[model samples]
Target: MPVVHHRCRRTEQKAEELTNARSKNRQMGPNTLLAHGPYDPHSLHGFVNPPVIHASTVLFESTDAMRHRKSLPYTYGLRGTPTTKALEDALSELEGADETILVPSGLAAITVPLLAFLGAGDHCLVVDSVYTPTRQFCNGTLRRMGVEIAYFDPHIGAGIADLMKPNTKVVFLEAPGSNTFEMMDVAAVCAAARAGGAVTMLDNTWATPLYFRPIAHGVDLSIHALTKYPGGHSDLMMGSVSATAATAAQLRETQMQIGLNAAPDDVYLVLRGLKTMGVRLERHQASALELARWLERREDVAEVRHPALPSFFDHALYARQFSGCSGLFSFLLPGGFKQAATFLDALELIGLGYSWGGHESLAVAVDLSDRTVAKGPKDGTFIRLQVGLEDVADLKADLEAGFAALAATAGTAG
Candidate 1:
């Protein structure tokens, strides 16, 4: 007679339910799918949230079970717990990916795929306006390792093909690139990368999956900083790399080999945040667009770099690709760093900080000195703003004060 463990049977049953749910989830709207993603109340004794399983060890039923531990749901905590699986499964669904892997921070999401797909002799193409940390890693680590790195214009589009060498293994993209918010031709870049036999990866954190799904548009791996909108709060730090069927194995293998894992508690928080992501993002988009419009009209503002705004250079491209906009965007203030400092010093409600996609509004003075190309207006101070879920009227008043302070500064200089 053969023995069947209750826990193992339960795990198998749960996996089946999740697989079935994923198919049905594709039919639901983003908001509806988010609420029901991969979490079955019936399976967990009528609990709405998945249980956070803090674990490092797995108990086996017998000699056969121990010998074939690979067949089990989870072998160790570092591999994943129920909590981690819940989040990963949800992200995979949102991203329209075969699998989604977790890491400690948003930057890890970028580095993991780079490491997975590139080697010493391989060449990589990165957007000129990529996140500063990504550029730093390529210049420092990837360069030191003998990987040939090249930066390209964010708007290079299908022209990226010209830069592809025989060894170009990866082409990294960040649309509405970093602080300057320059939009890219995502589909064109991905297609060119595919034709060149190079893997394509995009930092989709700014748009989240709700606004954009990278895999559907030929991207092999869609990267996100779950610490932002997915966490919806400023408390936790985590990142995710969602991969298509072609890239999933490599992404997962690299993550496992590197022993990378997000904290169970942080994963749980992000799962909860996902349920409300749609609603929070609505407020964020509406508020940010309204603010960007107002900034564009002000005399103190030189340029507003929000893709959603019609005044933007790539507004048509942004309109064609993105269904919605996020709260993070930048504006150029007239004058230099000193003038930017004065404007920030006047802000009372918007915090002087780094990172966006939180419940609270934040602003930071951007330094584009490291950029080799696509450097923004050299004469003005670039200020990136993360519009929070604050009252739009109140946010306007705070900025009004900032402009007033600049006026006072000019008066004193005279």
Candidate 2:
């Protein structure tokens, strides 16, 4: 395998320029930054969008250039292209980080940071409410690598200090955790990790940089699954890891070592998605909150676990930390998995699927039995919904149909 060095003067200069520009426009809101910060239309002959450059081989102009490939802006496609750089720049700005690296998927975004920081004999404190795949990776691969992994309660907050050891290298967190929607005190957890000499990382996919800036909250690395909200169309897959200056080089080196790179086309699509993410997320937030409120009034709903709702246990924390919420949240049905299946089967507008953050509404049955520390809403069947840009009235009507199915199921079962 060819080793491509990423510490090129040209690349650094471009990134520095972007960073300087961002500093000058500190008062600009997210929407304005998303529209114009990372891209320069004038540089590309006044084209609005960055050109997608598809290339694996970057030829040197002379023998001297070939010898100094490490100093050049780009030596190979795997290192990065103009398309990749554009997205990275935009995401870095959004995340409030010094740099951002792209990966093949959201899971990779999580794994890369772990691999970069953890080694044999090291310990990792992972919140139990994390994305299931992330937990699996830690238990399976990290354990096999001789790294000790511990699942701590999502609500542990400052108490995370007790769980840390001298060998602890990373404290992993997912705010308003997966499926269960339990929020963590991010600043508190980061403080604990920092005091214990452990790096703090967060999966910021749900809130994004628009609602929650993880780096600003003292996180060392901010990870995002661009597959969801950033893709916005369900047509692409990519993930990003944005890091502070102290950790950026290590992340980039580990990424290069692992040969983790997203496709150029996928990078372009995500860049396109980022442009409209702010507006799309606003719709998602409004529709989801409206739907959550409607579900709260229903007699069949056992519980609504949306952080944006005042009823949620962590609503106060969410209010203080997050600027807004996304479209994804979970609700509990009255019965077991049977009732949940029936409810899903009855939905007309909401599609039953695995991934969200697209233009369409989706619902999935969630079972948290595998969770040891943070078993969520175990009394009833959990249903996670991703509200799309559909009309709120229509979405409410769709859920009304789902509830009708749940009621019919109960009647039949009785």
Candidate 3:
């Protein structure tokens, strides 16, 4: 029986090596041909998709080999397989980071970086308009862990230096702050954090690595919620953190210690989604920008809160920092809750969903007056919109119906 099993193990390793070599040939990292990007041939899976691999126990060669604990490809399924590492390599190359690690979701992406860098008694300066979960985690988990989290205005920029204490360890940033779309000067924030000997991290989910490279502007780490755009089809949930060699080592170590590895299937889905992201993002950008302008011209709108728009308060900062605009934007409705609700309910094509970056449009109302400490967009009523790959004319017509509903509910002219 032992002899038979030994032969079986050898056969499996040979098969795996062939698979790994083929996969490596398909994807390129930082050194592929510039003209022809990495492209996969037609998938052989029955559904034209990569089959999900569920693995856990990875057998080793011998007791001697296992005892040394030396690196021998994938020792355990929990760490990763070729399918998973291929995705990680792809993300690392895209972001120009020395290394990348995947987490379960976008919030996981944020929390893990914070976890690796922060300890009890450390101080962290978080932007006032950061993703709400980040705030909750800081106030709830980080606070309980004895870490001090202080919220600061997104526009503080270089002035954030004032808030840094001697123990300040991290400066967390989110550009074009959630829902309200306020822009942040990443370079300015990094300058402030560096002077105080603090690490800087940002949720680069909006303008993905293709549009913005946070590390080039002095940020220590760049994070992306792959679920939104990178997983453009919305079929998978994943997050990534990419950093320079020095910082990547810390995050990688923490990722292993916390056992935060993602499933190989999720990684495969994201990798597939990433292949055509540029084209999809372009459509999303054009459609959303058109809608932002249309919203700005409406008398019912207080403002079209899109960083790509010239009328946006932080337009100049955005133009300087980013190469492209994303599908996400927000606008202030003429009337607060009553009118906003009416408009949302009257929509035909748009859905009332929590996430964006898919092939569909979504709307959500957010209020931040109570959460911000500094000049955050304290407004009457705010509504965020994610313009999908729909026709501009049809989307505009849908808005017309929504405005009519708002007018009827508020007893105002449309």
Candidate 4:
């Protein structure tokens, strides 16, 4: 057989196997995760949700199979179980990845893809406003490994073409940067990375695959902190990395070597979370939009960094690439940390917490002087908001109380 034919045949088989895993009844048996989740084939199980499989070990039948660890297929629990497989399969479908690997947290999601694609002496281009820990990983850990990390303005767009180096291995992007929420030109960056022979990875947690599919945008790999949206209840901590067929095999192998596999329960929880994510996101969006509109009209507010908002700096890019928006965003308060603290303390409905993506709204004071390099305002009180599934009117009332407290305490800066 010709080489082209041989390659095509192998690709077809892999695609077929992956497809079988998705349909819930195409012969791989009903995927327990998707039977009521994404892979509902019969549509007759009538269960509104997928069953949660909590298992550390999957027993195999034959001795030969046990010895080779190949009898029932997935050998050990860490390698993943039907539960993990179901979640992986479900996410793989969502992200359009040839394969997916689960990790313990959202940060793990960032580090796994980084470690998989980069090596000593290789160069990395990272967005400045990335999740702080991710920026730290590139500077601290990747630097320790002799890898060079370069920071380019997030809004550089196609001009990023100028930053490419011969040793550039990967380009890391986070749309609407974690704290400041400035949308980047995802397609432009991926195109430049492709021409420069570097893989592109995006931390797509802000929008999730439901709102934005990175694979369709030419990204080589997509990372998610399933802890946020996919694990919508915020009860489970999980991360995932998705890649096309060529890179997925390598990612899976690297994932095993690092032993960063997430627990089966986490996998199950994430799977369950995925079911209502679409609906939950709509709720989040509604509340967030109302809240952002309210903040924009606030006496102490300088700017709102929501992509869906017309006032956001990168609203144009976001409007171009994203199908819809999510609830996570930030805004600038007039005073610095003092006002942020005052407003947070005054809030009755929102919690002041380090982490977000929960049923309850959250607020935090963030400083961006060191991180903000673009045309963003120079000095402002940074407050990030994770708009939760709450009544917009109630959330607004809570914020109104917060503003009242801020006015009383800070005397209301224009």
**Model 4 backbone overlap count:** 2
Candidate 2: tens digits of C-alpha lDDT, residues 71-186: 99798999999989999989998888999999999999999999999999999999999999999999999999999999999999899999989999999999979999999999
lDDT of 2: 0.91
Q: Mind giving the per-residue lDDT tens digits that candidate 1 earns over 157-192? A: 999999999999999999779999999889999999
Tell me the lDDT of model 1 at 56: 86
- Give the alpha-carbon lDDT of every model: 0.92, 0.91, 0.82, 0.80
| Candidates 1 and 3 compared by TM-score, better number | 1
Q: Which has the better TM-score: candidate 2, or candidate 3?
A: 2
- Minimum summed lDDT over a 10-residue window in model 1 is located at 1-10
Give me the runs in candidate 4 sitting further than 4 Å from their true place: 1-72, 412-414
Q: Per-candidate RMSD vs. true structure? A: 3.1, 5.6, 5.5, 7.5
Leading candidate by TM-score: 1
List TM-scores for all candidates, in order.
0.95, 0.94, 0.87, 0.86
Runs in model 3 deviating more than 4 A are 1-52, 374-379, 412-414
Q: What would the C-alpha RMSD of candidate 4 be, to one decimal place?
A: 7.5
